[model samples]
Target chain A: MKIDLENLTIKKAHEAMKNGGFSARELAQAYLNNIDKDLNAFIVVFDDVLEQADEADKRFKDGTAELLTGIPIAVKNNILIKGKKTTAGSKILENYKATYDATVIKRLKEKGVVFIGGTNLDEFAMGSSTENSAFGVTKNPHDKTRVPGGSSGGSAVAVASNYALVALGSETGGSIRQPASFCGVVGLKSTYGAVSRYGAAALGSSLDQISPLGKNIEDVEIVFDCIKGEDKMDSTSIPDKIYKEAEKDVNENKKIIGIPRHFLKEGIDKEVLENFENSVNKFKELGYKIKEIELPNIEYSLAIYYILMPSEASTNLARYDGMRFGFLKEGENLLGDYMKTKGEGFGKEVRRRIILGTYVLSAGYYDAYYNKAQVLRKMIRKEILKAFENVDAIITPTTPTPAFKIGERTKDPVQMYLADIFTVPANITNIPAISIPSGFVNMDGKELPLGLQIMTPHMQEKLLFKISREVLS
Target chain B: MEIKDIENLAKLSRIELSDDEKKELLGEMDSILGFVEQIQKVETGENVSEAGDLVNVMRSDEDTHESGVFTDDILAEVPKVENGFVKVKKIL
Candidate 1:
């Protein structure tokens, strides 16, 4: 029977697999055939993809198939999949393979999900655009000339362009959601510790979360449910009680959406702002109250994120010494070996963050920069938590603008970082936030997507999904 | 940051940068640090998060074997290995 990979979702695909509409191998092949190699979304399309599909088919035949069974999912390169090449888009580990699967990967495998391939990302998940990838950039499917917002740009494109039914992307700040917004898909950044980070490459450990980007919120929720839970390996992973507390009925009268009017003050593109305003009115028309609120310390989020992210990143990345694993280069001396191997292997953005991280953590400046950022981080979290007291969720534009032309903001790293202004606060507060497609805006005759970001209190993913479904509808 | 500071950081980070990279990085460092310098304005006097809630997590001490798919395949891809040990430059 004919299969339409373009219109397939995990839930739809599951029903088809159960009814034997087509074999999992056939569905996998449909995706493989539809993959546009020029998009450069995938790092490695597993050679044994059909073999995994066949295994998933066996589960369906045996009546053991689950929601994700037989559904091919793409993973961002940073997350480990046992024995597969996991580059994290850096040249340092270009030839390196995972010794063990990430907790999320293991969970999906147990559910009989088929592994499609690993997708490209910003090297070490550092940059806003996938331009930092040591391999070539993954072009935006909407307009090939523009960037597919990143560091999970490839994962976003994989699902956006129908390369995979759904894909996994990790978030340090806005890695997952921003890309999803740019690619016109749904991205969910789960609350920190909601999912185990056992085998994913560490970036900003305090701010990092494994997120899912899908064609819709329902598909993302299905993937998120499979992966989220506490694990012995990740002590920071939250207990299941948090999920229980979050599973509450949607309250229309209690659904007050908070908008920080200050964030929309300047630099946001005109059309993007219009799209956000439209979403606000749509929610208002749907009986959801729109309240204008103030988050006092939010202005300092970008600065705080910059300081904290690099400080944590530099410390976390110290493990990549050339001696043990990754690409190695012989030098005149031991120190020289470290210098040459790292200098040659790491991309520019990674190096920048490392140096910046080292400086902030260095003597004399530590108290002023690192310590102050920590205080501000807590303040930002408290402010967001306080805002949730009166409002069920907070709303903002996912990016200041849609996907900009490639090389537009690369030269100036600060401007590139500004693209994540609205999205970074949720990562700071460890809140569950999602970017769902609001509508599209025309840019130079091309229609680019815009996203309305909804942030709820920590462990309140149910409200986030409830509100996101309303917004998308 | 100055060129001398960049040199010190490069040494600390153990990454060699060419002359051009050093100059380029020096300018970028100045701008980035200047940008993040805004955090100093935050008024965080005496209102820190409670310390008790921030204690380090410790699991019970026990001898347990780890069993997974990990194997010698990871070692096979290393640049240099000898007698099941990764080979590195002389330290002393």
Candidate 2:
């Protein structure tokens, strides 16, 4: 039977399997056949994919299948699946295999989701484009000359290109949302601590969140619900009681959306601005009120992210010395061995960030860079929370522009960083945010996708999902 | 930022770079630092407390898994493993 890969959602697939329209193996094979090698979306298409689908088929046969049973999903390479090679898109750990599963991977495995493959990412989730990947860049499915945004570029491509039903991506700053915007998909970055981080490669410990990207809002929400919860393995994971308490404060009648017009004054593409205004008008037509709000300290969000992320990243990356694991290069002495191994193993962007991180945390500069950024981070979070008191959710264009060409911003690190300007504030404040495909813009004679980002107060993912559904519908 | 500062950072980060690479990094790091320098200009006022509440989560000290269950698996990824120990260069 021919499955409609483009319109397939988790619900539709599940109902089809239950009604014997097609077996799990047949559905999985349809997606497997759709995987295109030219896109470079996957680092490794798992050899055991069919075997995993066969197991899901058994669940359906035994009347024990759950909603996620037989669903084929792509995972970001930074996320570890036990006994699989988990390179966070760096040469250092290119051959290293995970010894255990990440908490999210374990949960999905329990739900009978088929592990399709490990998708490519920026090394340590550092860069804004997948161009930094040691394995070649993932091209935007819409236009092969353009890049799929990163560091979750590969996962976003997997969903957008119909290679998988849904995909998991990790975000530190704009990693997940930016790519989803570029690929015209729905991406959700759950509130910090809403999902467990254990067994995922650490980039920025304070900022990283495992997220989901899919073809639409409901599919993203379904995958999020299956994987989110407090875990004993992750101390930062928020307990259910906190989410329960936060749910009490949710005003069901609130329909006012806040747009920080001051933040959108410059650097945004004219077409993207027009699309954003149209999205706002659509909301107004749907009986929702739109208000111009001010977040006074939001301009510093990118600066704070650069300081805090690299500081944490350098500290986190210190573990990859020659003796323990990963690539090793011997030298005349111990220090030389460490230097040679790291110098040769890490890519240019990874090395640059590590050095930047080290400099910020170094003795004389620590107070000036790292500590000041932290204090400002607090101010930004407070300002955002204050805005939430007057608004239901804050909205913005997911990115300043559409998917850029592969090598357009590679030479200029600052230009690449600016791509994330609109998306970083959510990560800075640890709020729940999502990017949904709003519309398209004709760039260079190609209609590229643009995304609308909606952010709610911390742990308010349900509100984001509700508003996202309204916008998309 | 100076070339000497870049050298110092390389030494501190334990990543060796060629002289040409170091020269290239010097320019790149300068721009990146300049971009992030906006934070230093913000008047954070008197109260400079860090963001978010810090809480100490405690759990009983006990073995959650069987001893040595993952010893081989952990050692398998090591670059050099010898007789159940990770082999490394002599410090002295």
Return the TM-score for each candidate structure.
0.97, 0.98
Please tell me the TM-score of chain A for candidate 1: 0.98
Fraction of true interface contacts that also occur in model 2? 0.87
Error of 2 at B38 (Å): 1.7
For residue B77, model 1's alpha carbon misses the true position, in angstroms, by 3.7
- DockQ scores for all predicted structures: 0.70, 0.78
Runs with alpha carbons beyond 4 Å of true place in candidate 1: A246-253, B47-49, B53-56, B59-63, B66-71
Docking class for model 1 is medium
Q: Give the per-residue Cα lDDT of candidate 2 at A163.
A: 88
lDDT (C-alpha) at residue A250 in model 2: 76
* Residue lDDT tens for model 2, A53-105: 99999999999999999999999999999999898998999998999999999
* Ten-residue region with minimum lDDT total, candidate 2 chain A: A245-254
